[model samples]
Target: MDAPYGQLIEAEPGVARLLAPNPTPYTFTGTQVHLVGRDELAVIDPGPADAAHIDALVRAIGGRPVAAILVTHTHKDHSPGARPLSATTGAPVVGCAPLVIEGGTEAGFDHLYAPDRVLADGESVVVDSRTLTAVHTPGHTSNHLCFADEAAGILFSGDHVMGWSTSVVIPPDGDMGDYVRSLEKLRGRTQDRIYYPAHGEPVAEPQRLVRGMIGHRLQRERQILRRVEAGDRTVERIVAAAYPGLDPRLVPAAGASVLAHLLELAKRGLVSHADEQWSATA
Candidate 1:
């Protein structure tokens, strides 16, 4: 099957895809947004720092003034080009502070993104007649946000939600506790008819998909608990047993998920971790 990005499907009446390049492993999918209603346009999650991708965005906008460049998070694949693109278009880049790198790791290129505007939850930005409200939904990363276009009833879901695979819950930055809460928050929201995720095709059934994601995570947590009860005394062993069918290439990512669950369970005193191993405590 063809990759979802580059497949231009109408998101709403005036919005059209200047599609992101598919197969770019990090972004894997890309989307350059165009808004038709208000003459004013905004590009969300400009994929990567690729020169060609930025050029494609410029061509798609056709000299239309880009009002603002909005970002959901500061992951390398998502926000590295914000500064350059903002310089080209004179649009103020807006988002959470660039992610901080710690303990000898370089700051993932995202640290260079100095957003001119910092968006908070419930804050709204109006471009022409369309109003995009920021919803602080942190999970995939501690700094993720989703924008809801009130006029279009569409949610521009960055990695917070995706149409393809479930997002990773990597630690020290990604939190499963917050991830679950964010999913529940979306479940109670009212104005989302379509979801334009940072990856994969647009999702039509937002509520249903959110429910499925929530259920899947809960099931995984239970599976981990079962493994702990069955004499698995380490995250590695528990992950191997619980996620038996996961691709070998994805084991590292799966291990992170298991770590997140273990951390959450430890916080609740339902499990304990000692000397690099896990065990049921309650």
Candidate 2:
């Protein structure tokens, strides 16, 4: 995905996006911080605390009054920049309530966010001419949200769904059960025509991708179940069986994802874990 960072890339009539310069293997060409309203601009996912990114956002607005600074969730890559941007523009940061998540060890999660106005599910806020509704879709994290612009038929599907790659569902903060339910919720909603995902290109057929994502997750679960039934119970072994020739750099994440699925399956009484080994329940 090409991110025209310094200038505003017009996505549609009222929507424009600024790319943050903090791209990574996970972030995928930096975070696509969006300017939602044409006149009374609403900044969404300020994208890290880098001065340059925030300055670029301010520049793109071109002295427009920022109605609100909205956040999709409190990940370091998503919410850390909101405070600095708000301080610069005097726009109150509003979105999901902060929920502390235990990141275990490597690649920690952010819990230092507090929104000025907490938005509940089905809550709508009119900024400029657009009505952005909050969709409480928790999966990637306990407080993950996807904002839906009904009039434009575009949904800002945070990290919950992406066009570039499947979202990584790690345990502790991430839940497979909630992820599946959230995908179902999006599939049922007809208001969204395109998904402007945080880290990738716009998803034109969101429902089709949602179905495929659901199937992919379930199939992975089945593979884990099969591995467990075949006497491979630990996360590492399951990851090895499910994702052969996996990149060494991604092993930790793969293990976390398998653990999340195992935990979910265990919660549903479909599997059991004891003495560090898992088994399919009869």
User: Which candidate should be chosen as best, given lDDT against the real structure?
Assistant: 2
Model 2, position 47: C-alpha lDDT score: 85
Tell me how far candidate 1 lies from the true structure as C-alpha RMSD in angstroms.
2.3
Q: Give the TM-score of candidate 1.
A: 0.91
User: What are the clashing pairs of model 1?
Assistant: 20-30
Per-residue lDDT tens digits of candidate 2, residues 37-62? 87798988988999888888888989
lDDT of 2: 0.87
Residue ranges of candidate 1 with Cα displaced over 4 Å: 1-9, 22-38, 101-109
**Where does the lowest 10-residue lDDT sum fall in candidate 1?**
29-38
Candidate 1 per-residue C-alpha lDDT over 1-282 given as tens digits, one digit per residue, 9 for 90 to 100: 254443444566766665556454334445444333336777777767778777767766668788888888887777876777887999888766566656544344466678888899988777767888899998788889988986677888888888777888888778899999999999887678888887777889999999999999999999998899899998788878887787787887888899998898888999997798889987
Task: Score each candidate by Cα lDDT.
Answer: 0.77, 0.87
Compute the lDDT of residue 81 as modeled in candidate 1: 66
